[model samples]
Target: MNDIGGSDTIKPAAEAGRVTLPEQGLWKNLGQADGLESAAQAWTPLMFGQLDCAEAVCVFLVDPEGGRLRATSHWPRTRMPAGALIGAAEAAMENNRGVVRGGVGDGGQLTGGLVSVATPLVVDGIVLGAVGAEILPQDQTDLRVEMRRLQWGAAWMRDVLRRDASMADKRRYSNAIEALNSVVNVAEQKDIATATRSATTALATRFDCDRVTIGFQRFFRTRVSAISHSAQFNKQMNLVRLLGAAMDEAIDQRGVVIWPETQSDDPRATHRHQKLAQAQAVGHIMTTPLYSRGHFIGAVTFERPTDQPFSQDEIEILEAVSTVLAPVLDEKRRNDRWLLSKLGESLGGHFIRLAGPGYLGRKALLVCVAALTAFFWFTMGEDRIAADAVVEGAVQRTIAASADGFIAESFARAGDVVSKDAVLVRLDDRELTLERLRLLTELQRGQIEYDRALAARDRAETQVRRSQIDQIEAQINLIDKQIERTELVSPYEGIITSGDLSQSIGAAVARGEALLTVTPIDAYRVTLRVDERRIADVVEGQTGTLVVTSLPDTSFPFAVRKITPVAEYADGATSFRVEAELTDGFDNILPGMEGVGKIDVTEARLIAIWTRPMVDWMRLWAWRWLSLD
Candidate 1:
């Protein structure tokens, strides 16, 4: 009997009755009537109950050899005849579907004959076995229903078979993995000759091949360097030469090649390989190419007896093994054993691979890096530094108290647009008016007294009245000026930015005290708070755009007018207060409206523009560590 891994194992047919169904419940159609006899015994009873069949039902499964079908139950021991529904069962298994052959006239409940239904248990497209059932006489009225019920039972059997096949495949896969690990361990050996001999021997042992040869590329041609059975062989030997030629044939094709090729799917060049295998009486042959640094480096060929041709799974495993050993073999060819040398070789190999052809992914990445380097090195872009900024009027003037008086009424407040000389606040003027009237009456009396004194020839009286008249005139002029100042007016046609004397009505204000700040709405300057480190790049006349949060959709262009040497601390950073005037007016720009500004400096390479910060930091770091005298 052949085991799951295609290895021959000895087990008595009677022993199969002892094995049981796997613990993991059944899945798809892997059970050709379920696993060997013991598995069938476990499931046949349940299928019998669910299928509405007669008491006697038989399930026969195909043996692993695929030649004969064995009964799962103790059916051969029973009184059932060989010809009893065996044809129907075989038909179902062959067709891979359920079949109901006996019809109403052929077999009916009235005649005491029950219909027979059979179904195939298939898994992964291979028919494993089939189940035959004799429908209950009463339930056999409709052959279609009986067949459907039998099919459902067969589907369950298929699930059971599928599970068994899956477990077998998994076991086989594990064995393949272990074999690969062994070959890989040999490849890891430092000495090339020893590793090659050991790996070849291991491959022959694991794969049960008659011969295994390792060939390497020399001068663009494959040369047989190692053979599994013997380290020393005559190159002049016809068999050895033939094997070398076969390996080279596979290597030149640049892919996995199998001799006695089964696949009509691929365009095959296995003529030399097949001829050599035939001449040597080697049954099967396969060669897999190895690649290193994105170049074809060598090939490993396996030859076995006629019966054990390479399966797709084995071919796949060998291909993976080739890939795993390529780099190691390349390094071994260099004959370098030092750790640092090996590391450098590995890195160099990677660089070569990146620079090599045929690998689209690595090639694409190299192209991208080169393009980016050129773009950053040769292309020039604007060098701009961002700064926190706010809009302010070009000429912001403060409205001050004109005279010492009490505020009476307010006409406008901050943010109010006012015309030039527009009244902003009214001050009390009744006292000034009364003082003006008294001064006017005193002035008239003083003038009359002066004239009378002069006519009566009194010089001293005339001098006193003349001095009083002059003093009275001065007092009246002062009262007139005080009265005029009662109404505080805007200095210009602009918006009131600061003063809000609405709540301070009737409050006394001293002369020259700032009452309001009015700024022209049309003229605006951006006060930029540039970081001290970047302030040097923000000299006067540098032009850029300003974008405020309020009018974010619009960008106002501006030029640096002045850079304040004095620094201010805001948001935990020290920045110089730089002033920039807008080259173009914005209606939305207002005093104290904050936004961010970018100042353009001389154009520079994109690499320099992006990496300036890192370069500056490195310079600072170098300065910190170096003490150059």
Candidate 2:
């Protein structure tokens, strides 16, 4: 028994006496095409002749696929009935082990024992088949040694099968490589027209096809370019139409279409291939799509007779060829004519094509886009002027130090909301206190002097003392006022947007220096940092929406209140500040919270609304250059 596949037949090899290898003298009259019958007969006798004390021997050889088995030849002329030999070999194959069984009762020349022993012959783990023989308990008690002999014989048979399989693979790959080289050679053609002709002819000749047609996408339909072996052909011919339709079907599906696809269940395939083949009186048809950048650009159809249907391998090779062909063909098509001519042809041919058959879906989309553009451009869209706006207070008030003094205490910081008369900061008033005391002492001394002058009745002394007292009183009052103003207070109900007095603690501030800024909460404004380019479109009474980073999903409507004439540098670009008032207030909006705002200057076309920014940019750029020159 011998096998050549991965199936249960027998266990590992065992020790045995060295037997004569098949390459030495066995298989002397063998041939591959005869299914190894002659080799089996030639080798079996040699294997049996080496075994000692065996009553009878019969070899069962299994096919490489493990699907069939045959009794090659029996040794000792008549070992046992043919049925008994086959049954024994089959049992070993099924059980994947050596077995002992009673003979089928038509025995010949097997008087050693009542039972038959079948040992599986396996090579490379492939359960080939088993060798059956009649042996007694004393004839061959060592079963392992007998099984080893069978394996030694099977090794030679496995080699023959492997070599046979390799040769066929080698030939198939060789042909595949040659076909690839032909495709490469065809792609090297300089001109598209010539390339098409050469490629079709080369493909037809190499693949042994009755005919081959190459076609490319013309607008939305396949236009035949070249037909194998035909220099001149009618475009309106029925056969040409059928070929074009078949090519179109393949290209549209982005896959190969094979006629009589009796062996496929692909959902993309159609029976149109069969229809075309039958109409053309061809046995088989195969249409392979050519793609460039994933778009189906063209296809090539092959026709053959019934006896020579295209194999899967041939179709696969053609698919690879199509990949190499598409880009080169596309480039050739582009260079075949002038660019201006192609552009002009495209312009004039568009309307004609739009009204033609096919691409109804794409045409519908084109119509929709055009209509949407017209509606936005001409039907009156909201003319909104978009700008980057910094949220600010409409009326901001500043708290300043009254005199030159060191900050003693900071009662408020930026972002701290406070009411009117809220103490924002306190200044050191020790100097003012000393000044007031000195002035009070002077006033007391002046009063005493006045009393003395009055008691003496000296007119000149009285006048001088009265003037001194008035001067002292004025100085004391001024000191008291300064002390009161040292505690800087907010002038309005608002948030402290700037001037954190905590940073100014113990720091000397001059008279009238701002301590902190407080902007009123009721009056909110968005200072839009609009690009200088679009400043003209921004007027004083427009309205738009605003969205800030903090509250992006919500929109607050605002009306343009003022457009600043000054330009400021922001984010490395020159922009103008346009102030707007919030018409409808929303939460999370606070002064100094920057956001984006759009002002509806007027209604404009959708195209204009979108393109105005670009137009304005171009105008400014041109103006800048013209002025520079």
Candidate 3:
């Protein structure tokens, strides 16, 4: 028998031969009733109603599995008994797809009416099944129609199967996404590397790889930890270097790299990895970069036992697993640094205590305390001197305009302690009033002339009435302007300290000028300047007892009002301006009385004073240099 499998007689090229064009010679060769069973049902009625033809038919199914072939459907079989197995089915499964003239009945009987053609059923890369149709010799034209119908039926089946396969792949991808989410959500406790290794190992087992590794990239080197399945496996360092080098290309370019069958003959791929692969019997290699927070953190690699390239689905799984490992690795690295620092601290403490001089350290401590005390006394207690400072009422002034025009207006001069809004000047409106009156008189004169020019008509009388109305309006305008400029007020209200205008009249004042300067008459603040070297020992909110020279030995309570950051260059020294407010201003105290102010900057243990200055000087010098402005 002629066959195509395992033989030199049927060449691969001969089996690859393509089908002839169907619209011409083969188009008319297929019978209408000789198509697939479903096609036969559709075309049989058309043939019987239109063409008046009825005939026997045969259809064969060609299966790729086991290269088996079988009779799928037959016409007149129920009445005439099952038809014998035909050689046409075997011929159709082979040689891609072709038409052949063959006899039926187990290779015994003559069945020349059979016109068999095989149509391949393929979806993606998988071959499903093929269809073969046989027809009667008398209905040659009808047989051609049947063959064409079978051709279209084969193509339709291929499309339906392909859609189903694509949908299945999508569902698989969705499941992978969910699995990745679950892995990422797991809590990351201490020992991040072990946690990552545990996760990577579990994933590698699921994907059926020889080994799985997790690593992070730092500069030119990649630090890797190999988490193998068997306990006998030790960490292999050389493998880490090679994997890091190989991954740099993919990571820098943001792409994927696949190396197939690298067990031997590749110098770029590490021999150490090859040995491990040999031990584990792996054949394929896939490395994927791990990305987090829009940066490439590291990579994860898998080793397989077969040379088959990883499918896109498998690569997606690796990427998803890498996402889960990224955070765990970063946490582990941070924890490692913390552990080393603690170890260093423990050792340094012991070394310093065992190797230093004893007496010198104690004497140094005592001197430091004394120096600190002196500094506090000079800076913070600078206002607390032996001489006394008195509590006196603040000085104030009130000014009013000397001349009277219209007394235009006032902006809260009386009882108003304004900082800058005191108004003591105004404008005059008498001249404006005179102008309005003059204009009104002119209007009346014009009215009188018009009235004389016309007596019978009352038009001139209307003009005279209009002029009188204008005179009244002018009077109202004069009153408004006089009222607007009628008042000249005091600048500020401080018990009218300087300007007591209730008893004075016609006090001429300038057009625009300051009337008074009002200071608070109840409370008072004493300001003193302290040397810069002593400023730090002073602080805000410090309290001190105050004595007034005017009151002899009597003392009053006081507090630090403020310590200005600005330094004043005065009296051959740099000093900070300090202000202190007393609890009460003296009832009979006067301004400009000479007094002294003092404060206590510190009260510290004696030992701290001696070293404080040197410590402060070193601190300032170090800060100036190291902080670099």
- Whole-model lDDT per candidate: 0.75, 0.74, 0.53
TM-score of every candidate: 0.39, 0.39, 0.28
- Predict model 1's lDDT versus the native: 0.75
Candidate 3, residues 491-516, lDDT tens digits: the string is 33333323333332334445444454
Candidate ranking (lDDT, best to worst): 1, 2, 3
Candidate 1, residues 199-275: lDDT per residue as tens digits?
Answer: 88888998899988888887766777789979788878887778777878877778888878775666768888877
Candidate 1 weakest ten by summed lDDT: 1-10
CA deviation > 4 Å runs, candidate 2: 1-380, 617-629
Model 2 CA lDDT for position 82:
54
lDDT of 1 at 463: 77
Clash count for candidate 2 is 13
Q: On a 0 to 1 TM-score scale, where does candidate 3 land against the true structure?
A: 0.28
lDDT per residue (tens digit) for residues 138-231 in model 2: 3334444655566566565556555655665776686668657756766688887788888888889989999988899977899899998887
